[model samples]
Target: MSKLDSLLAIPVLDRSNQPRIQAAVDGKAKPPRALGRIEELAVQLAVIQKKSLPSVRQPQLLVFAGDHGLTRSGVAAFPSGVTVSMVDTLLAGRASANAFARVVGARVSVIDAGVAADLSDRRGLIHAKIAMGTQDASKAPAMSTDQVISGLLAGADIATQAIGDGADLICLGEMGIGNSSSAALVIHRLAPAPLEICVGPGAGHSPEGLAHKHMVLAKAAARTDAAEPLEVLTQFGGYEIAMMAGALLASAKAGVAVVVDGVICSAAALIALRLAPQALDYCIFAHASVEPGHRVIMEALEAKPLLDLDMRVGEGTGTLLAIPLLQAACALLSDVADLKDVLEAAS
Candidate 1:
């Protein structure tokens, strides 16, 4: 069997709490605002005032990088060192995300959430480490509840500050090895889907490696207590994921648009929706990733992803790609000559 097939073969345990399930299922809960043709026309009208008017402020990209203890168990196809290496590549402007962000005219900020390696002297990186790394989910809890809350708060604070610094739109992304396992655990808790549907071949794992990952995740899920969102996050979630969730909430509260990337970011978005369903008003699903479970999460949230380029690289590449589309949307709404205006001129 392929890696995805083997992972899907494992039975999913019911680890969701009643309150969360009820809240997620409750239709009376504030229904998400679906932007249809009329809403799209309205958004266009609001922004397209005049060509001479200043365009909306430049978008900002926030990339959160951390290390997952699950990597130590060979659950991932890439080594743990890749996490630090990718951060360096990002700093050096050599990563694919950097190139993509530059093309979209978005400024990228890299936050060191909790990479195991020291990045103390990195000049441009944001130092927001909550711990050396998250705890191994296979043997014990991923992090303390307090730690998870702190990480989330810190991430939100960063996004708030970025907006204050003149950012109008926000794109959420992450970098971490073995994070897919953490994402799977979070999705399982938040959505109550089959384990196979929640899990995917992160970074290209072989069949045996993927099966091993599924078994470890199944064991972790079995041991977790699903009483509350925070408790479940502490039990089996990654620090970066929790922080991204917090950032999403903060962006909504701040009234800024948030573009969500692939599966990992979608996990965070799911948590954000659970914590504050109103936050959905400020979100835009950027893309559908090659990861099998990403589409499932997107559907659950009723999110219509903007792009589907088979992108599985995390670091906000998909979100960055969507920035130009958003710019075009705003431009078309505000700049195009209306039929009335054209008729008046002709007359």
Candidate 2:
């Protein structure tokens, strides 16, 4: 097996970790009541007849923006300027995510995890910059451990506060040039797969550029110890990815459902799962991305993505689009009429 495979071979927890799951589920559990089999069937019948469950009271979208040093190595098709521009677009309510958030009634919040350009601390922006930019990973470590830890802590704190602000559902998105490379590194470290299986043409890279990206990432991995996954993230992952991972952890801890977008967000989810396997119970895979490696990661997580719009955008667009489906799932469980209700209507 390859070194990447061996790293992923490390066994984490399995289904036996019900205590953690119970902590999340029982956090809001009520006392059990006695019921006859007929009554049990009646409750199930009622659920089928209703076809909709209790509405999710509050949903929040957390967008993390950063800059990747690997962009300096020409790994990404888009320049770092796009990160700042997109942040402005998001703030102006003109981005695709903004439009989708409006459709779902989700509150949006943006965080400057490490954008290279300066953003004014205005309304709707969370000032959580860890560094102006990560170090050039093509040459050395992308970020120091202190910066990564700080970013993670900031993200966790923000998520906890959002939960306290009455957010029951959390959607994760990211903005960072060359972030796909950082995601690939994290995926490589956490997944039982080859680097090539986890690398893809991010932001429309040409074949040659994609090859260069894979080579640089492989060399970087060779220089690092895969045994320490968080160390790999600190050294090679994007600040936004690190922060998003922490947000996933916090959401799990807070008993909120987390919706994960495409590949980059999936990478963050993988890292979070690595840290706390129970976190997976709270995550819903949003969509299948066009990126080549995304499927492999999804398979490793055993996640069935809700949609396959061929989207590769990292600004939480996929997650935003998938919100309605979640609503529909709840609706099906609570609102749809069952056979008994139909027979009664016929009578």
> Which of the numbered candidates is closest to the native, going by highest TM-score?
1
lDDT of 1 by residue, 1-347 (tens): 83212211322222233333222222121233232432342242232221222244578989999999888777889988899999999999888889998888899999999998899999899999999898888888889877987877888888889988988788998999999988888888787577788899988988898999898888887886573667777887887898888788776666567889999999888887776665675678888998877977887788788788999999999999887777765554445554455567889
Model 2 pairs whose backbones collide: 50-334, 50-335, 51-331, 51-334, 51-335, 51-336, 52-334, 52-335
Screening candidate 1 with a backbone cut-off below 3 angstroms (N, C-alpha, C), the clashing residue pairs are 8-196, 44-333, 48-334
- For each candidate, what TM-score against the reference? 0.85, 0.83
Model 2, span 219-255: residue lDDT tens: 7778777546578787788889988988887777665
Indicate the TM-score of model 1: 0.85
**Best-matching candidate per lDDT:** 1
Where does model 2 exceed 4 Å of error?
A: 1-52
Angstrom error of the Cα, residue 265, model 1: value is 0.7
Worst 10 residues of 1 by lDDT: 4-13
